[model samples]
Target: MNALILVADDEADMEPLFRQQFRRDIKAGRFDLVFTTSARQALRIIGDAGQHDILLLLSDINMPEMSGLDLLARAKAARPNLPIIMVTAYGDADTRRRALAGGADGLLPKPIDFPALRVEINRCLAQWGAGP
Candidate 1:
């Protein structure tokens, strides 16, 4: 099955960038991405989808309604096996620690290095034995 990725970020600009960066994978049918501007919207998507096909979540740390950490916590509660990668412009040891404690599987600091991000994603998939 193709991996489903849920991307939550309040920034309107990020949507296009994410789509552009992951376009190849998306076209290859390696991943199905669901993008939302808010954590609440993401949660709604998860809830409405019944059985979530989501294998991973890529979320921004700072958001209006709910933070990515909160989202990670909720997603973990809903699906403990689901892996979440936290993305942020603010990268620090404390933030990383918090994310890890909150159940994040990985972290990507912005401005994101796309090549490194791709490597990390592949590594994550390999670790989960879900890679092609």
Candidate 2:
């Protein structure tokens, strides 16, 4: 099965940028992209589509109703093996600790560096023995 990646962020604008940045990888059959603008929407998407192809989740730290940490906890509870990476504008030791303690597989600071994101995703996939 093709690797599936879920991007969850409240900012609608980031969706296109994520698609654009990952387009090459996507076209190369590296991943299938799924997107949601809120944690609740993400949860629904995950619940509905997660069992099939989803391999990873990328989420922003802050959102309207639910935070990324909450999303991570819920997602992990539902799918323990699904890798989750949290993105935040505020990257501090404390925040990183919380993310890690919350079960994030990785953390990224925003104004997201796509190269780094790709690298981290690759690393995570490799660690899980899920990467091509």
Candidate 3:
């Protein structure tokens, strides 16, 4: 099965970066990455359940319309079983604490480590029993 991953980040280059990083997995049909430039857009995807069967979400902490933390909370409330990982440049204690408190499945530091992300993704997939 191809797992859909929703990515919410304001960074313009993130889409290309993720595409390049997960090229193999994408081509293999292991994952389908969907990028949204804002939390609002992410919310739309989360809200419209009929459209996207999201298996995981990777969102940046800071955004223009709504913060990723807020997005995390909302997404979790809507889909408690959904695994959401918060990504941020600030990997400080407070940030991590807030993310955990908001029910984030994991946190990834900025300048994301693709190898580590791959492991994390696999872990989430396995936990949800949706691994390829």
Candidate 4:
């Protein structure tokens, strides 16, 4: 089965960028990416059992209503084993520390380095004994 990645970001353009970047993997049935504009929606998806076979979560820190850090904490609480990576343009030292403290698996700054992200994704998936 394909490994699913749930992404929470307010930026509408991110959807296309992710889909384009992972087109090859998507076509190969290795990975699937799902995008949501808010933490609420992401939390809903996470809370709903068997809604999606999510292997990882990629979230933007500076989202509306709730921050990614908040989501990371809640998501971790809900699914302690799920890997979460925080993606933000404001990746300050404090933010990194807090993310790690809150149980985030990784963090990426914008504009994201897709190559590095791919490496991290593979590492996370391998650690979880899931997809490539």
Candidate 1 lDDT over residue span 2-26, tens digit each: 6677889999898798789989888
Better of 1 and 4 by lDDT: 4
Cα-lDDT of candidate 3? 0.90
For every model shown, what is its TM-score relative to the native structure?
0.88, 0.89, 0.94, 0.94
The lDDT per prediction is 0.84, 0.86, 0.90, 0.90
Error of 3 at 86 (Å): 0.4
Estimate, for each residue in 30-53, the C-alpha lDDT of model 2 and write its tens digit. Answer: 778888899998888778753556
Cα error of candidate 1 at position 115, Å: 1.6
After superposition, which runs of candidate 3 have C-alpha atoms over 4 Å from their true positions? Answer: 128-132
> Who is ahead in lDDT, 2 or 4?
4
lDDT of 2 at 30: 75
Q: What are the per-residue Cα lDDT tens digits for candidate 4 across 1-132?
A: 567889999999999999999899889877789899999999999998576778889999999899998999999999998989999998899999999999998899999999998998788778767657
Q: Candidate 4: where is the Cα deviation over 4 Å?
A: 128-131
**Quick one: how many clashes does candidate 3 have?**
0
Candidate 2, superposed: residue stretches over 4 Å from native = 49-51, 124-132
Candidate 3 has its poorest 10 consecutive residues by lDDT at: 123-132
Clashes of each: 0, 0, 0, 0
